[model samples]
Target: MTASPPAHDPEPPARRRGRPPRTESAGTRDRILAAAREEFSARGYEKTSVRGIAKAAGVDSALVHHYFGTKEQVFEAAIEVAFAPALNAPEAVAEGSPDAVGERLTRFVLGIWENPTTRTPLLAIVRSAVNNDTAAAVFRRLVAAQLLRRIAAQLELPDAELRAELAAAQLVGCAMLRYVIKVEPLASADLEQIIARVAPVVQGHLTAP
Candidate 1:
């Protein structure tokens, strides 16, 4: 009857051209996160903004908000990505000889900081955490939920949580001084030398008699 009303209206070219490729995809979300990291690294938490992140990412500000919700949420996401490798530290403990778990854990974490790709994002995250309360909260949650608690589980010891925190403090302090503060000797020191010295303290924290 009227050619069945042409079945359906032709899709609008403008709408099709401007539409997001999909509702959400890993690739787009990652790009937003990577851009946010660069922005935070360059500007710090207090100075960085969603519009800047979106611009750096070549997307609308709305897209950044769509993917990450808010600037604090974006920081959390970025921290999560940067620390993803370090989260596997529990495995380093689980797979190693009980006595040597400290070195395994230390080596695993320092190795992440040693890589330029991972370190850049970490620098941004740590700097943000130091300067912003919200960033610090995000960092703490990510560390506690994804890393320290799991390592504690593997210890099977009293005060496992405290042990995990102490071990974390040892490694994290070293990382901050070497990577972020750039203290001369520590910054210039060889990775193995640092690990060799720090690993024992980490071991004591986790498994001292």
Candidate 2:
């Protein structure tokens, strides 16, 4: 029978070896994000390049550009992924009664930092921002614009923006101390107890007369 058609046409003539067909991988975007996080965390935004991220992710630099237009965009994506839980501050505050807003807000903020998955990337971002002006600017723009400003707008009180900032300061400072710096007592303190102490401060800032 013609040697069985030469076993499937000699394997299709060994397939021409030019460029491999580009088939999208399900995890490509996520892989890029993960690599971006690691790069930004290690080198800060200014030092982390698209090529660096692509190399880290084992893809071409073009792939990184394909997924994220610029280094700034990648940084923003990393921030969004890391702080997604805390981004719900508006909703957390909005869902609660005025008096309990602080508690809800505190719980929400701490809950994010308390989780191991979110905490690691966030710790890296904070550490990088502490010494990198570029990182700090990116952090400030994303947080102040998307989170603090929006939360402030929800308040009926005077100096709502200021209050929101103060509240953010309180939470951010606490997070820095507990999570980043790893200060004893505070770092290892009970989450509930910490919330009890911090919620009132946040509430005071949110509702000060």
Model number with the top TM-score = 1
Query: TM-score of each candidate?
Result: 0.86, 0.82
Which residue ranges in model 2 land beyond 4 Å of their true spot? Answer: 1-26
Q: Which residue pairs in candidate 2 collide?
A: none
Error of 2 at 172 (Å): 1.0
lDDT of 2 by residue, 1-209 (tens): 11111322322111233332334343666787898888877776778898798788776666666557778778888888977777888999998589998999999988988988777778767876777787788788878898988889888889999999999899999999998788999999999999999999999999979
lDDT of 1 by residue, 1-209 (tens): 01111213333222346664553445667788899989998999999999899788776676666667878888888888888888778888899589899899999989989888988888887888889898888888888888899999989999999999999899889999898888999999999999999999999999986
User: lDDT of all predictions, in order shown?
Assistant: 0.82, 0.79
lDDT of 1 at 75: 84
**Number of the predicted model whose lDDT against the real structure is largest:** 1
